[model samples]
Target: MKGVEIRLQVQYRARVDESIEACHARFTAGMQQFGPPFGWQDLEPPPAPYIKPASGDMIGVEWFRYPIKGLKLQITAQHRHELSIGTDKDTSDDRLSIEFKTSNKALDYRAILREHFPKLIEAYRGYRAWAVFDYYGGRYTDWNWGPWLGREATNPSYQRLCKEPGVDIDGRNNIFTLEPAVFWDNELCRRALGYGPEEVMRRLQGHALSVQPLLDGVYVVFDDDPALTYERFLEINKQFKELLGIA
Candidate 1:
């Protein structure tokens, strides 16, 4: 996993009937709780871009400056929403992507994972979301085009390629995930999903790196060791499947 860097992703549905401005405001307020100087730069260039707190449209950013050791965050937003609004209308899923790179050779990514990962998870209040820290979890790269020609390198094909080894093809066999997290979020205790967050914590008691409760979910760190490999991740995911009986 030389080229593979640790990625953090959180996926959830947008609030019912929430405008982009309202959504943006709520998001920024929550993130700001992580404290000042952790602010976003609107990537959508202004004739006046959406810069106002919580009341702007189509806000985007490439880097968010965080206070930890001058670690500039690479932020990507994939929240797709339509103009129509109603209680009956289904909200679209939104995602925030962050990355920790090897460029800062002086700092250990694992140390960052240990310290700020949960705080970052707490900073976002999504309707229903799951945050995860994994190597290449659902990101696109040249690997998709490496093996196939023009048509096959499309998004769906790339997703299938990323998922095939760690997940069942139909995407239902184990929690709708591909590369599972070394650190992950479980929102709302997931009672409807048949496993309580505490139960997962109990089951993974000794084996897990760390498991902490969030306001509405649980944060799990699978392994913190420097030697963790992709193959080892698959093994831990197998253990996860068995412990939760989701496989």
Candidate 2:
């Protein structure tokens, strides 16, 4: 289904301890303007080992699943001490708030919001948070997009390369270039491949073809592997590459 991605950056002057609660109140109030039976539920905290810091830091995130519209919303508030407080020792705080919304009837939703939540719309205009909501009316598939065994550093560098294209040898703006090309001194490759300098040198000495790291944690094999065999790697890589390319 068609949808719109709405991003709002919000700024607030408040105390660090109160920022979270204040944000919650603002969001709840905004949601209330949308009317009842909207069905809001908090998403589980990012699965364990990936849990974000809960300390008094910048950007407190709250995720919600909107049952009525089947939309996902992320509310993020970032504490800005420098801007809010004149000096480092000062306790005053400011927050950058962001919200994202996606929905099938985007125009209608926007009109409804503008008419019912004028303050929220106004807040969105000057807010400084990194919030965005993407509503899609389509099925989502599960696909792994993380580093694989022996390729820890690969994904990060690939992401960087994708972001800034000069580092790519093929000039394709794609990290896959690094896959066939030798790792050289790229740190991401080292992390993803999970090999130290010495180990990388040793492996390259014997292998004719090596795995190419791609964005979203997939790899490509350009050369044939006889000893360890690249088939398994190629198979898994192809699967993810296809999965990620799908809309």
Model 2 misplaced regions, further than 4 Å: 1-4, 14-18, 26-30, 33-57, 79-84, 87-103, 106-110, 116-247
Candidate 1 clashes: the total is 2
Cα lDDT over the full model 2: 0.33
Backbone clashes per model, in order?
A: 2, 33
lDDT of 2 at 224: 24
Roughly what TM-score does model 2 have, to 2 decimal places? Answer: 0.31
In candidate 1, which residue ranges exceed 4 Å CA deviation? Answer: 1-3, 35-91, 127-174, 178-192
Residues 84-185 of candidate 2: C-alpha lDDT, one tens digit per residue: 433321123232332333344422443323232233333322211222223110101112234452322333434454466243322212223222112222
Lowest summed lDDT across 10 adjacent residues in model 2 is found at 135-144
Which 10 successive residues of model 1 have the least lDDT summed?
Answer: 42-51
Candidate closest to the true structure, highest TM-score? 1
